[model samples]
Target: DDILPDGFTKVKPRKTRRNKTDTTGFPPLPPPKSQSETSHSTASDSNKQPVPNLSVTSTPSTSQVPEDTTAQPPRKVRVTPIVLRDASRWRGVNHKFISLGIKFERAVAVDAGIRIIPKSEDDYRRIIRLFREEEVPHHTFPLPSERNIHAVIRGVHATLSEIEIKEELQQRGYSPLHIIRLKRGGGVPMPLVVVILPKVEKSQQLFNEHELLGLAIRVEVQKNSRLIGQCHRCQKYGHAQSYCTAPPKCLKCASDHMIHLCPQTEQEERKCANCGGGHPANSRTCRFAPKKNLEVIAQRRNVSYADAARDATRAAPSVGSSANTQNVDLATALRSLQQIIGPLISATQALQAIFPANG
Candidate 1:
């Protein structure tokens, strides 16, 4: 007990109770709710609004969505090229074309002339007609690559006309653009017929034997006779004289003049300009002659000129090695002949001894 001042009060400490441990290993659980309490809690839950699921999403149907038209790429158009000869004479040709409302894809200067590529067939025809109307010298023929594939059919009777052959081919489900009667020198017709067909898989089927008018005829791919162009103006291979801009070169002596104007006579030694060989430049015997034809082989085989040249170089034997190879082959042939002759002579002598001659 203590003496208290006026308006002063004493306070007592509060007591805490200690929790008792369960004899079982598990802790004690809460008591179950009463039936009325549970019913009341269920009623409260039913009254509460349901929460929406933020993770779930729904997509629109394909039929309801608009297509993306801008996503697609545009198709490209194929253009045809046309060549105009003597480009120098066709000055201001582009302006003239513009005035005439002619449309072209592009124009490129080539060795022959101006090569104009038109966007459409209508423009191609219009350009051709314009050239014809102006009396301009232009080549309208398609390039070798642009032309349809050609195949030769042999064993066909010369008496059969082109129309008859074409009709027969049509019956066999082949659409031939043209049929030509192959002729020899001096216009003498041969049994061979050249058929021009479209560049399709079916066209290859023609390279086989077929029955025509009760006779079996064989067909083969028409190979190009000359693979390179020879320029008459310069007496060089690769281009024609009309398109050649090179200076005149004589074929006889390879001089820097026209063949007719060559001062060199036949009595003088012949010289080749291309290979400096003893023969003429245009001679088939020239070492470089095969190189000129490589272009044609490359074009027909659909390979690059460099690849064809490499193949040709590897195939062609060197002059010195060729001579040695010929000598070796000749000696081998002689030895084989001697071996054969010795056996033959022995057989003949034996036969003679067995049967004596009446004389």
Candidate 2:
């Protein structure tokens, strides 16, 4: 008991911290339960129903998940194009079609006439019937495509008429659309016929040789002539005016107008739309014209334009070399003639000398 001053007081001793396992500061816990009480509590818990946990979500297993089977989009349908020859009556024809509720894919104005694309074969047949009923001038020839097969039949006698050839082809279980005799440049008929056939599984059979009118005829696939299509409207190659989507271009002056609407006279200076030359767009002498043919051949043969051009260059004979070769041949011919003539002259002189006494 220490005495302190009037303004000061004695300090009490501080208590030490309790150990981590000590629970003296906290409220005393209940005593440990007996084994029987623990067993009873566990049994009660097992009998009680479990309350669903709203806060915690359980994800579904992969095996329990449903698969997605969404359908794919439909494929595009192919359309066939048909040309109408009478362009002047196209407006009336279009109006009539619309009035009749006739459905077509589309129609475009072309130099030949109106080119109408139909959605189905039924529509094509219907249009053809309508044209024939109306006495309209129209050509229904199919364009060169995979579906159209053209073959050349050689050794067909000119005396055999077209009707006879058609009959013969039909008798051979084959369908022939048109059989025309081929002709030379001067309209001289040749012993060859061009046959147009529809594409079928047995279309290749036409390439085999066949006997016709007691004469064996050879058949061959018609080779592509590498002919390019020139669009009269745009004055461009690789496409025709009927299917051309380009704007009109004048052939005479390369103006933005049709040939019939061109204001230039015959005496006016001509301008080409393709090469910008003095000639018209369709001139045969254009340097760029051969490129168009190459493009056509490349597309038909499934080759590149450069490769086609290289092949054409290799196939064409050199003019200078050909002329030199002709000159060499002529000189050789002259030398051979001189050698034969000299020997003959010497023999004739010797014979005359031997027969001098008789003279």
Candidate 3:
């Protein structure tokens, strides 16, 4: 048995190797350090955070954000609304402006004013600036009325009275309306050939839809006037068709016998080749012998071919007539047989009397 001294019986602890802090009686640990504090420290000092041990692992710290460095905030711009005024009543009109319920786009300012002159001028520039933009010039003008009087009078269709023409001019914006007197006669309707002349300044400033319309009316009237002298007799121009001096028949009628020729009169007259007479070439007696017989007969026939043809045509059955077989009735057959037998019996009796011994 292993014997121990009485004091040596207590168990002794293992001794560990000495650490760097063992002489100072403290445990070894990492130096406390931070990026911000290190950045604030002088470069000469070795105050940097300790580099992690090559073999040791460390828990990751929560993420940090850098301080903001922006100098100033952004600014917003202010916009004004635009409204159009004194615009041409006949000039340019916006579709969006007319349709108040539907929006064209976001609101934007636009320049608006009256540019047409003497009649209207700009008074609401502030409101005009609310529009986004102006449309391209259409160069359209308005129909004349009391407010814009004085228009050129164009020609008229159908029959128009002087009072009617004057009223039309007044409505078309004409001052001191003038009308060219229309010629009245010879198939042409009431035709006018004049235009109204407005004052110089206003006429010069305004566009010319009226003048163009007037000129067009004059042209149409002139063209129709030239056509009124046509002839109605021959259906040809230059004279009345009733009084046309063309041939007994027109060129077309003579060529094709169409139109103007009386159908009843034409059918009654026949065309002849031999004598050019309005009758058939061969007479009824001349055509009889050759058609009926090829053999030379002793009979001197008096009938003509034309007459025979006519007779044959009359004797022929109509379109839906039945054949000979359809006309053979049993009753008619019996009557014919009786008549034939009666004649035969009469002949036989006469023969018996002639030869009494044979009977």
* Candidate 2 per-residue C-alpha lDDT over 96-174 given as tens digits, one digit per residue, 9 for 90 to 100: 7778666789888876567788766677767767777876655443433435688999899888888999898888888
lDDT at 268, model 3: 40
What is the alpha-carbon lDDT for the whole of candidate 3? 0.38
Which residue pairs collide, candidate 2?
Answer: none
Expressed as tens digits, the lDDT of each residue in 1-359 for candidate 1 is 34469756665566785777888878789789999999999999999999878875668889979988786676866565766767886567788888988888888898657888886777877887777777665654443444578999989989999999999888888899989998874467899999999887777788864778777898888987876666656655555665444557677677788765767644467777777776666665566576657778788889998987777655532222344456667887899999999999999999999998999
After best superposition, candidate 1 residue 110: deviation in angstroms?
2.5
lDDT for residue 114 in candidate 1, whole number 0-100:
87
lDDT of 3 at 135: 35
Arranged by TM-score, best first:
1, 2, 3
The root-mean-square deviation over C-alpha atoms between each candidate and the true structure, in angstroms, is 19.1, 18.0, 38.6
Kindly list the per-residue Cα lDDT of model 3 for residues 91-200, writing each as its tens digit: 23445434533222233232333222111212122123223244322111221221223332344554666566666556666443455554553334454544444544
* C-alpha lDDT of all candidate models, in order: 0.74, 0.74, 0.38
Kindly state the number of residue pairs that clash in model 1. Answer: 0
TM-scores of the models, in the order given: 0.39, 0.38, 0.15
Count of clashing pairs, candidate 3: 31
The residue ranges of model 2 lying beyond 4 angstroms of the native Cα positions read 1-74, 84-91, 110-113, 135-148, 154-171, 175-177, 180-193, 198-204, 208-218, 228-291, 294-359
lDDT (Cα, 0-100) at 13 in candidate 3: 68
Per-residue lDDT, model 3, residue 131, is: 34
Please state the error at residue 221 of candidate 1 in Å. Answer: 6.7
